[model samples]
Target: MVNIFDNKEYLSFFCFIFFSLFFCVFMLFLSSLLGGKSLSRYKHTPFESGIAPVGDTHLHFSVKFYLVAMFFVIFDMEALYLYVWSVSIVETGWTGFIEAFIFILFLLLSLFYLVRIKALNWTHK
Candidate 1:
């Protein structure tokens, strides 16, 4: 086996990483020491249009909107998987092709079911 420890490239890479980490830590410590001495009392309060905050930060959301968002996210994640399969199509060959087809078919079937069952219907509308 070739001696990896004797390589000049590996030694240079190690030195570069060591210096980068050391510089980062030194800067962070220096900033923490020098930059935190002048904090005002009003700097931490929440400001809203130069007025005091009003009632009820919590607002009601329609379930239909959440349902539509969930469906979009599921389909979006499926598209990402399809993208990965496309990127490595030659490596995965026919087995991957068949599997991806089945996956898409099932996703379509689920979408149809969601539509048929009115899962995506506007409840508030």
Candidate 2:
């Protein structure tokens, strides 16, 4: 029986990893050796568009904004799943089609639930 670790592919993999690490460490060392360390009074201060900021930098956002963002992310992920399933429809055959159909059904049900709960409504209740 041949050892997996003794394979040529494993040798190349190890060499690739070793070189990647060496290159990264060499670049970091070179940068630190040649980089500047100058300090000034303005070094720690925040600069925004070359203008000094005024008033309170921290601002509050509405919870509704967060809710809308969550909804967008959920629907976007569902779209991604459907796209992948579509790409391999032939390989999946009838089983894949039924699974995708159920997935779509669930997606529509969730959307309806969101609507019924008024979660998508923008106006304050």
How close is every model to the real structure, measured as TM-score?
0.61, 0.73
- lDDT of candidate 2 over 15-39, digit per residue (tens): 9999999999999999999999978
**Root-mean-square deviation of each candidate, in angstroms?**
5.1, 3.1
In candidate 1, where is summed lDDT lowest over 10 consecutive residues?
Answer: 116-125
* Local accuracy of candidate 1 as per-residue lDDT tens digits, 55-103: 8778898777788888899999998999999999999999999999999
Residue pairs in candidate 2 whose N, alpha carbon or C atoms collide under 3 angstroms: none
Worst 10 residues of 2 by lDDT: 55-64
Best by TM-score: 2
